[model samples]
Target: MRWTAFLCRLAVGGIFVYACLDKIQHPQAFAVDIHNYRLVPWALLHPWAHYLPVLEATAGLALVLGVARRGAALVLGGLTVVFIVAIAMALLRGLDISCGCFDTDGGHGVGLDLLLRDLVLLLACLPPLLVRDSGPALEQLWRGRP
Candidate 1:
């Protein structure tokens, strides 16, 4: 279970860091992708696009490094929840927008597929939060020394 949590952290954190870095490399295109979603108001879109990657990268790094691991996982789990909601809303509204998740090369877009994938990732993250204290090394859930 500890190993599972670690692997999950690695998978999710690496993807987040890579995705954020990819967007950081192409802010203009990412901003355009955000614009296409039409969820962010025009005034907020630019600022969000500019700053979101930094937060994502920071959180991702924190998760991957196991620095404040529980806190980082909680934050990222919350973010995944928000992302799921936003993606669901976009898909239901039939909005045509790039998913802008991992693949920033060009062919990214939001749809049922993206939502399902994010949902799976989100579910994958839940066990680390749910089944408390079984893992020997997790101080947050366990009662003993780390």
Candidate 2:
């Protein structure tokens, strides 16, 4: 169980960190991607693009480092839910746009596949959230636990 939680943390955290890299480097392009979704308001596009990546990176780091793993899982899980909703809305509305997931430029189009992927990522967040003790976490090391 401990190993499961640890592995789940690594998987979700690594994905989030990787996903944010392109966005962090290309905020303007990311803003355009978010605009393509049409879910965010015009006024909030820049801010969302700028800050969301940072948030993802922070949470991902915390999860990977085993510091505040549960909180990080919760945050990443919530973000996954939001992504799923955005993708579902895009499909239902018949909008053809890039997912803006891992990359802001030429990303794959929104589709059921992306939605399912996010669902799986959301599921991956569960163990860290539910498990009381994360295996070999930085938190334990910091507290001098063997």
Candidate 3:
């Protein structure tokens, strides 16, 4: 069970880290992708696009490093839920938008495919959320004063 939690952290963390790299490098494209969603107001598009990647990267790094497992899991888990909602709504409304999971110039858009993928990732978050003592978290192993 603890091993499961560790695996969950790695899977989800790796995803967020992977997802943010492109967006962080290509803020303008990400801004356009956010605009395509038409959910956030225009004024917020640039800022949200710019800062979200930072948040995603930070929390993801924390999870992977096992420095703050519970807090990072909560944040990344909540983010997964948000992504699921956005993807589902985009599919339901038939809006043509980048899913924004990985890249801004997307081959992957919000649809049944991406929605299902996000749902599976969300499920992965559960073990870390529920299991307090995840196996061999690096922070625990370090035994250094945090």
TM-score of each: 0.82, 0.96, 0.92
Query: Highest lDDT: which candidate?
Result: 2
User: TM-score: which is higher, 2 or 3?
Assistant: 2
Clash count, one per candidate = 1, 0, 0
Residue 73 CA displacement from its true place in model 2, Å:
0.4
- The lowest-lDDT stretch of 10 consecutive residues in candidate 1 is 131-140
Ranking by TM-score: 2, 3, 1
Mind sharing the TM-score for model 3?
0.92
Least accurate stretch of 10 residues (summed lDDT) in model 3?
137-146
Q: Candidate 2: deviation at residue 102, Å?
A: 0.5
Evaluated against the true structure, the overall lDDT of model 1 is 0.74
